[model samples]
Target: MKLYIAEKPSLGRAIAAALPKPHRNCKTHIELGNGDVVSWCIGHILAQADPEDYDATLKKWRMESLPIVPEQWQLKPISRTRSQLTVLRKLVKQADEIIHAGDPDREGQLLVDEVIDYFNISKKKKSTIKRLLISDLNLPAVQRALKSLKPNSDFMPLSISALARSRADWLYGINLTRAYTLQGQKTGYNSVLSVGRVQTPLLGLVVRREQEIAKFNSKAFYQVQAHLSLQVNEAVSFTAKWQPSDNCQPYCDEEGRVLVRALAENVVKRIDNQPATVSKLESNEKQQAAPLPFNLSQLQISAAKQFSMNAKLVLDVCQTLYERHKLITYPRSDCRYLPKEQLKQARGIVNTLAKSSLPCNKPAQGANTSLVSKAWNDKKITAHHAIIPTEKSPENISLNTFEKNIYLMIVRQYLVQFYPAYIYQQTKISLLIAGGNFVSQAKIEKQQGWQVLFPKSKKTQAADEQEQTLPPLTKGQILHCQQGELLEKHTSPPQSFTDATLLAAMTGISRYVSDPAIKKVLKDTDGLGTDATRAGIIDLLFKRGFLQRHGKAITATEVGIALINALPEMATLPDMTAQWEATLTAISEKNASYLSFMQPLTKTVTEMVYSASQQSFAGLPKVAFKPKRGKGNFKKKTAKKPAKKSG
Candidate 1:
């Protein structure tokens, strides 16, 4: 009998629907008419055994057992899904042919492959196994995937990369968490001091930003604006900002802002009512193609900024749109470009959107289906394509506010692919007035094009004031400076981290690194964590009390600050994470071996354990532990009043 093991039940049902019909749904497996059966794992059926599981002595936290490295790793069935695993074990023994169906990503590949390894199948049987990769649950997409099955062995390197990541995380997170928690206890703080490869560095970013904000000293700066009238049209006048000359360096800051009030006042007096000549006038037409479709991180960042939604909430909404409604493709995809073949479905999808009740339905009618954007490129496609809307209409689908909003976002972004590029003319005017240079610039929109779909918000409309149109002027044309105005401004401190900015920082972490080589690697690898895990890692920090949210701003807690101050620089910086990610990418591409990566990692972990042991935690703050409430106890508890003073 042919057997298919899927990553999850929803995916199993999707695969079953694409296969030969006359399906019989059993308690654990779905049987097809042609003697084929399909079963699924509930996420991951197996997980790496914990440290205590390896040895009883390691169960208790002690400094002596600092670095516990397992010689022979073990996998234990998760208790919640043990029954489904049992069914799979029995089915694996009876199957004559097997097909491995998992999400086409690293974690997905490892989850399914590990299950097959647990079955202890013969090498001959393993070589015969086929792999099915499905990104979209739509029946048509699934059917297409079914016809293009490849050997499961072709993805062994991907599985191995995931395995290395898992073990590395274990060795790093587990050992450091235990070591730090022990250190915290020494300082009379009883709570667990959690440390992670990604989360700790993320916390460090917040703490450092807070420090920078606290230490910043506001400085006053001055500027001179020239109110000028064109000689050709006396009624047409515009304001130009004064650009300091090279000789003005002594009186200005490094950013070219005038620092001395006297210097700015002198420029204003010198340029007042002066006859100005237009020195240079340049105009250029520019076209901006619509942005590429949503990758998980990009979607999360947008949702956070537009709707004040957190990363975790956005991820959850995307999953619902992808899995339950089947209205979108995979939610965890990292690629923002679609395969060129996806362009063939553009007309059908646009038609469906136009007929739906979505917010973009009216705008969808204006989409030029024949106009292909640069977003369609086969070379840029990763494990899965961008998150885009399926051809399925949402007319009859019941959606809550969040789901509808997220679905609309996905549809709108996809619809933009069929729209024309936004066209505008950028004009720059440079003028000379009394030996000082003044400049004015404007962006005149020639065609709304794709921008017609997005109406400007109040903030955007306010920004447009700076780009007002300019009258016709030519170089060497004389103009009159009506007056000069001196404006004083002060430098502002950096803004606190918000959900949107934090996610953006995590996505483009390279900007924060000082080393050019490391920065380039981070840019190439796409930030600190994968799209599938970033939200979870951020959520985990909140659960561990490492991060707290106030309105839309996220801040580290006192304990969080203390822990960051106590750890070594390597533990708190993103440099190490960037290096590991680059190596993992190499492993996935089969350019690097697992041992070559793990050996250095193990040595690093050993050094970290020793380093952590030597660090003093005396300055760490003590934390009050909260007792766990029993189930069904929903009542709030009030603290008892302190007794009268014993004196």
Candidate 2:
């Protein structure tokens, strides 16, 4: 019998549909369709043996067995899916040959490789093993993949990388969780002080941001604006470029302060509706390259930015779209582009999407061949090109609000790449008003390009309702000052971290570090977490009650903030994780040793544990909150408290 191993049951059924058979109706069992047998793993079918699995006494949850590093690891069927394992073992045991049809990536490779290891399939010499690779799950794609297969040995290196990641997460998660939970118990808290390499750093970010929020001191600042005649440059001029006596050194970060101190009555310049001279008009016409296709992280970021959905929520929606609807590609990928060959079918998928709530217009002309040189490298691609719509139009796939939002995002991003570069004329015109240099700029949209299909990009900053930019104008051209005012404002502190920005920070957090040279080196490296796990990392924070979302805003909980404050200075910072990712990526690419990269990190974690435990976190320290009354809040309580009711 020919046996096929699929990553999940739904996927297994999809594969089974394409196979020649008596059409074995897939249930929760491995069954034969005369010529073949198929069974699938929902998730990790087998997990590494816990300390308790190694020694029965360890099951009691005592702290004595500090570092439970097993010399030889053991695997046991995950409790929830033991039945699937039973069916799988029976099939693999009886089969004459087997096909490994796991997803074609590190995690998928690990999932199947470990399943085989758990069953000790190698010990049984009769089953000839060959692996199947499928990039998309449509029937034709599945049939094509079924005809050709490679030896499982070809995926050994990726499997090794996945194993390393899993083991490292286990080692770190197990040890640190126990260490902290035990410590939390000692500290009079009944809750487990949960921690992980990814979780801790993630929680630390929210907590620290909250702390910054708590510590922020509001100060009055202003910008000196001169309301001039319909002269465009003069009406919008800011005082920063105007030097006092042309000899005074400018403020480091106090340009706003200087403006605030200046009297509003001070009229720096006054002019009538004079013909403004065209001093310097520079226009640059550049094509906006199409956005790269949807990688998991990019999808999450865009969804969060556009629809206010969480990363995990986006992933869940995409997963449903990918697996259930079978209308899209894989949901867990980190690339956002399709292959050269996929371009033909991509247009068809875009056309099929005409039935959606947010349908695609006709595929843009030259979208296929106009891929910017920087985005067309085949080497950057691996198992998949990017997330895109499949040629198949799904039927009756009902999606919830979140799912619909994510689906829209994927469809939009995929379709946009084929649209023409957003050709525009960018003009920057400078004007020398009376005594100071003033600048004015505008974007003339010569062509809407692919942007015509995109909904307006959402933002949390001031509601810039103006979606269009003006055409070219001479520096001296006088435009009507329909509305002009010296808007008194404060020097606003940096906005608190949102999940989208937080993910970006984790990817290239070295930018926040103080050391110039090291920061630059770190800048060149990929961020702390991979696209696959970044959402999960954030979810872990929420699961542990380390982070909370208030409406669209993210804040750290008390336990999370305490963890941040209690850490030994290094681990709590963003740059540390950036460095860690840089090193890990090097290790993954074979440019560095994991042991060498992690030595210092291990020491840092150790030091943090000791320091956190030793600290006299005697009382739940009162968290100080400084709330600013936003020129509002104070209102007349017209209705009294019902005259104290019954008093």
Q: Please name the candidate that would achieve the greatest TM-score relative to the true structure.
A: 1
| TM-scores, each model vs. reference | 0.93, 0.80
Residue 9, candidate 1: Cα error in Å is: 0.5
lDDT of 1 by residue, 528-580 (tens): 77788889888876765667778988998876888899889889988877678
Error of 2 at 289 (Å): 1.7
Off by over 4 Å in 1: 232-236, 624-647
lDDT of each: 0.85, 0.63
CA displacement after TM-score superposition, residue 621 of candidate 2 (Å): 8.1
Per-residue error (Å), model 2, residue 295: 1.8
lDDT, residue 143, candidate 2: 81
lDDT accuracy of residue 273 in candidate 1:
76
Candidate 1 collision pairs: none
Candidate 2's clash total is 8
